[model samples]
Target: MKKTILAAMMFLLVIVPALSEETITVKGSDTMVILAQRWAEKYMQAHKDVVIQVTGGGSGTGISALINGTTDICNASRPMKPSERDKLKARYGSRGVEIKAAMDGLSVYVNESSPVTELSLQQLKGIYTGKITNWSEVGGPNARIILYGRENNSGTYVYFKDNVLEGEDYVSSMQSLPGTAAVVNAVARDKNGIGYGGAAYGKGIRELKMKKDAASPAYPPTLENIRSGDYPVSRFLYLYVRNRPTGTLKEYIDWVLGDDGQKVVTEVGYFPIR
Candidate 1:
């Protein structure tokens, strides 16, 4: 009888732990926060024991946290930079694993009330750099462009600067918001405001048309354009994890990659990589 009881207790011990897993800490790009939150919510449904703490401090903040071992995942809308890779390698013995979770066709949005409808990449560059302040300079009414942007630490900001702005500087007049949602709100109300963010945030806001040059008219960003690489500012959203993820970490990562979890990605405004 004692042997039987001992065996049953052992089985229960194993099952209890499998049933209740602790929370996984994930932090990173504001652009991916909405989708990540959705994943976290759904992930918790089957995994009543699993909790995911999702936070946005921008990609840089998330990377920093990852290096410090404070987070299990670093979410990003852009690929890891060399310096950041080096830092992760130094701390974790190798650069953390990069998992491309979804795709985003970024949009430059403005107040719907604004007359401006299109802007070539060059015109956008000029506008953001303070070289061309008036909307009329880019096919709109005579009004100063109120530039809204994600802070320098944001992956969206870095991606935009590297691609569309061609490494140009943001104008001093630009207001740095905390996240993409904030940028959307700012542009939705401010007629003179123009901001760039992930396409997921494009719903209530009007997307600015983008052109490569005078030869191509500005086109609205779309999923097809992003997947085909025609959307100039499209980017991949990723999750960076420590090398050889162990324990629940591995399972959580696997869950996110699975079809059920990835479905949430599309629903939340991102193109699932799967």
Candidate 2:
């Protein structure tokens, strides 16, 4: 009778784990959506019982999702505002907070064939704001500068305007793309067009040197400069979660900061903060 009861108890233990919760969700940061998707794919391989869902709309979308308790994590390409912090505090307490995930040098790019190589921060501001309408104004041939910029929803656009343009509005005639890669592709095809994005996405195009504080850094973007902080436009990437995360959400985030997860970040284009 004792042996039979013990055998029955072992049978229940085997079924409990199989029936436990088996899925996880993460959302945020349109800028990192591509990389996030790639990470999700690999994670789900060994963790077949755990499913990870990722989506990209914009940083605001991600933050809002976190506040509403609609997502496990909120990815952002920009730092949070004081007001945003207050909102999260209201909802989840001060302990609910933000994490730095990686670093990126925002890159200004033009068509590869563009004759111009380097540009000053002041020149970049003028060009983006329509003050310098002609390429010749900055030493290029006599051609109207075709501004291709990210939409207002993008964190990159907001950062550029606030940091480089001193909160100036973009030129009225600028073409706004939906995402970073879109801007890169658009500028690559138009000899007169110029756009900006994360340094990781600036391949096959020429980065416009942003001269800061009279310092002569490299003429364009390079991984080395980005890591060492010589690149002025560089900034940290973020992920916001409750200060004390729980469950699978915590597991996933902890993994991202670990060495193995950082390797994935390096493989995908962004610089690993590790």
Candidate 3:
């Protein structure tokens, strides 16, 4: 009987520690996925007792998860919409907390071999809105211009539509990919292809210098340019929670907004909030 009790006690000791371990769920923003993953990895390394699960289904999806109590953190490339906040307030009686975790310059990408190197915001609007269909229209080869972009559910897509296109619709022919990496990959392979995404995923492709208008000097999405507001399409990357976080959740958020977390942001090719 004593041997049986000793074995049960040993089992409880192991199981209790496992149960005591804390888990954090982070979801949203395909544009922020790599950054979020890097943050999770570094945080987890220091906090062996905490587990962070990160996923990306776009910012809208992540916000929905937060509303439904499915995620502890939602990484958003754009601000939460008014309707979303209303829903959260209705469901949780809290207006959700927003944290500006990093900054990004929304980058326009093209094939490496393309001749076009810069575009005015107006020109970008025309090209994406189906008003300009050929590369020749933008000083490139005579080939047809192929557009690649993210799906409607993406915060990137929403931001581009509102700010770049000025609420105009994307051309029906635009290929809607799942994530920013996919958009970058699509542009890299097609010589006449063009796409937009976070600056971090600009590998193997040419990122165009952006002008606010034809008269403005074009600027690349460099850290200095973005920080100085010279980059035309710079935006904040956010982390949203359903409430004012406390306990382990708050600790993780505090760390993310700290110097070490901002260092990770720069290392991952984004500008720090600070």
Q: TM-scores, in order shown? A: 0.90, 0.88, 0.96
Best by lDDT: 3
Runs of candidate 2 exceeding 4 Å displacement: 1-21, 213-215
Work out candidate 2's RMSD over C-alphas: 4.1
How do the candidates rank by TM-score, highest first? 3, 1, 2
In model 1, what lDDT does residue 23 have? 79
Top candidate when judged by TM-score against the true structure: 3
Residue by residue across 109-202, what tens digits does model 2's lDDT show? 9899888888878888888888999989888889989989888777777788899899989989999888999999999899999999887688
Q: How far is candidate 3 from the true structure (C-alpha RMSD, Å)?
A: 1.5
- True lDDT of residue 40, candidate 1: 90
Q: Using lDDT, rank the candidates from best to worst.
A: 3, 1, 2
- Winner on lDDT (1 vs 3): 3
Candidate 1 residue lDDT tens string, 182-252? 99999999988999898888888789777788678566677777787666667789999878788888888
Comparing 1 with 2 on TM-score, the higher-scoring candidate is 1
Displacement of the residue 225 alpha carbon in candidate 2, Å = 1.3
